[model samples]
Target: MNDELRERIEHEAEKHALLNAVKHDSEADVGAVVGPLMGENPDFREYGDEVPGVVAPVVERVNELDTEGREKRLEVVAPDQLTELESEDETDDRALPDLPNVDEDTDVRMRLAPNPNGPWHIGHARMPAVVGRYKERYDGWMLCRFDDTDPETKRPDLEAYDAILDAIDYLGFEPDEAVRASDRMETYYEHARALIDHGGAYTCSCPAAEFSDLKNNGEACPHRDKDAETTREEFEAMVDGEYAAGEMVLRVRTDIEHKNPALRDWVAFRMIDTPHPREEAGEYRCWPLLDFQSGIDDHLFGITHVIRGIDLQDSAKRQGFLYDYFDWEYPEVLHWGHVQIDAYDVKMSTSTIKALIETGDLDGWDDPRAPTIASLRRRGIRGGAITDAMANLGTSTSNVDLAMSSIYAANRDRIDDATDRAFLVRDGVEKAVINGPETGEPPVHPNHEERGVREIPVEGGVLVEPDDVPPNGQRAWLKGYGSVRHTRDAFEFTGDGIEVVREEDVPVIHWVPADSNHPLRLRTPDGDVEGHAEPGIASYDPDEMVQFERIGFARIDRQEDDRTVAYFAHP
Candidate 1:
């Protein structure tokens, strides 16, 4: 058993003991329960509720001691639970598809190939995690392959590639090897040549436009009847650039009468005139189709497992056919469904979004509305929270509607403990003058004394949110500390209040002073609005997510430049 897991079980026991004693209104030995595993296991956050009953008494005992005694005796585990403690260790470390008893002799390898069409989206981020998680669970390794084929569609952008690798690194996955399909063209050609030699494939003279009509009517190509030797010669000629782009294609001899016509004599190779990213630009009449290349790669790489989204499940079967023809061993295939993002009619394609950013129609990939990883980070979302959210969405064939608000809520929970309180002025109006030293500075956060507070100093003038500015003869509470009254062009408050602005008579929003220049802004869904708070407004640390009193949570985007400080308005 690993030391980490052993310590976690014992720690849970101690916590249980302390809580029980504390509930009884007695001094509990928190130290005894928390000390043993404190340094050993930094990973254990909160134990799941399904802890063993045997450990409950240990926690209760720890809680019964006085504070001084508790500190000395608060060992996580008693000496008695060693065997079960080891069992707990194994369980905690175990991952899903639970392959604990796999024979050590069996070698397992897998591959995760992502298409380099655009920046990897959140949906694709889960791909590497799933592969890596399963690989760790089964004690296997996985290859990271760049499926950069299709010269007409593939764009060679190092930035996108680096971003993908960075995201993979962020997810803690290291590929056993990295491969690009574009680099293996020669290998694909060898397989194509072998298929032609065996008479399983032949060159077709049918025009590209005729494919649909032929598939629909079960019409055979004119080149189908040519002898194997003659077809081979023509295929070689085609590869050597003897034919026009659409003059001929190499096709697998499949059942033309099959119910699904897509499988009927599908093209195994095609002629493309486009300049290749890796290969020298020449007349390339022989290009292995996607399904064909993937099949060959699986064999050469010895991929034992293939986990991809359900969208590609059929690709697995198509490649399986190629494997059977080539007498290659098939890998175990697992299909995860797509993440149907709830975007409220936003174009979900990464290409469109990228175009918008590049063309200056949108800010950048990190724009909060873009839904990229950088965007999520800028919005103060936690990586673990995204992982946890995806966990709730199991590997079922069904898709889940992941609302944007749900993601924000998860982020909010993660930063709740770490963030400080801030006051922001969204829409402001000057309140009645307090031209004296009677009003003191307001604290940054109420109730968090240890975090202490930054002062929002009171001057001759104070800015109140436009709604908070009451009409003549009304009272309004300033929330958290106190209340004040508003009269004709003046403001006053009494601890024993007579009359001015009554709380019921006036409803006002909260805002900081306009002239203090503490550097803050009210960020709305449309755009950011720059504003200022009272002088010496609380110091907001970078990336520190805080809730402005009554204005919602906003993270401090800048420290040095007051005008550049941006806020993410809470939805």
Candidate 2:
């Protein structure tokens, strides 16, 4: 782990230690702090042996402070984490921690800035989802900003601008207005000029390789000490396209000997000769880099809080220099660590997904296999479920692996009652029942009798999964109907034999009558599962969620050629 991540874990451990200290008369138990810290950040769980080493010092430090000092320290580190200390009872840990320093009455403005290169995947959903939750939590306004400035390396697709907004809407957020960085080129230019005049930045003609060598050695560039007037002339010339792409760049002025090489006078703006994908591609050539562009825009747009990934923590430092130059106060920043979805092994990189799509190795963004928001939405995963799962992760700077089961659990509560259950058998084998009922009337849902029963036409020829029948030909219960004995040739069905089914230690299996079964094509993340659905499945309309008894949950997509196409959610 990097020092930054380690530092974050130490901070969390300290917060827990302080809270425990305040709770127990200014002396904290190491056990209390370590348990809660491990719960919040999974990273600590792996390095369990090292946790006590990290926590013992924190516990010692907290015990030195008085009750008042402990409380004050806890408030500074985690403002709203303190519980009501009057009762000395157990405290309720709310699923989502409240955003710190929020004034619910004020117009709290947060933003979702996405580079419009591709549609949002599962990882990208967290930003807008959290922002939307916090927006409602604080009665705040949200802005959808398309960071579409880069046209050469990370080209912006024209469709991705609207695609990202669609994703935000899919997450149940409506940004007050959508803005594009490309549209604010003139504003970026104006600020670049202002920075040169303020003696905060200067144009440098250093070759790219030479600058890298000097920056690595902590040496100043040749044009570092130029007067503001001369820098202004050079900046104007660079902006007016006098400099070819990569010939010159506007660099923010900072300590040349800064400890971090990346922080030493980073490039603010550069010329890109490649035609931008935007309609006004030819109109502008000089584009401000991400740090400079977002620094200026965040102030201009009045964004109060910015939630981004922990990997870009240095961007905030880089933007701070710009903020200092303009004498502007920086917005509150929140960073989250990487989120890995456990269900899919595919990397959640947009560029990687786009390349796979282009190569036809995978389907489009909405493919059942793809982990994009569009894929989930198309598969009938509710927006509320997505947002709730994301909000549950909350704001933690530890690498987390998210299980798809958690998502399924959240969605099950949402769709279980509303969906009707039916019988669906995949890779079915035909069997002749010795005494089968003419019709089977299973309730739409076992939990709700008022929903009524579905009339399924049962006949001698029943279709059941080949695996459901024991190879040893043992007796098994045919669910909702009767007991059956799988023989070498066929199954001998017994009518209403609940006692007989309970007597045998047997598996209860669901079956679709061959005569009444409808063709079904189930699209799942694993792959397509072709099956036969009971006649009851025909009653449900398109986009309706349903449970296939003994199988799993699915959403009815559409009907074509007497076949029902549905998307399988989970088992």
TM-scores, one per candidate: 0.72, 0.81
Poorly placed runs, candidate 2 (over 4 Å): 1-93, 103-106, 471-473, 499-503
Q: Point to the candidate with the largest lDDT.
A: 2
RMSD of 2: 13.1
Backbone clash numbers for all candidates listed:
17, 0
- Cα RMSD (Å) per model? 11.8, 13.1
State the RMSD for candidate 1: 11.8
Best by TM-score: 2
lDDT of 2 at 459: 73
Query: Which parts of model 1 have CA positions greater than 4 angstroms off?
Result: 1-109, 154-156, 225-232, 237-242, 277-286, 433-448, 470-475, 479-481, 489-491, 496-510, 521-525, 533-562, 567-571
- Candidate lDDT values, in order: 0.60, 0.78
Candidate 1 per-residue lDDT over residues 1-571, each given as its tens digit: 3566656565665653443233333433222233223323345424321122223334445544675454334333343343333344321143235432346676678787877666666777666766666677678878888776676656545466667777777656788888777778788888888887776788888877787788788878677777778878888887787776677888887777777667777888877777565545333546777888888888888877776667876677666656667777787777767787855233666778778888886687666567676666665666655654554455666676665554554454455445555566655677654433334334454334576655544554567666456667765545322455677665565343212123132332344544464656654445667666545444556776766544446666766643546557342
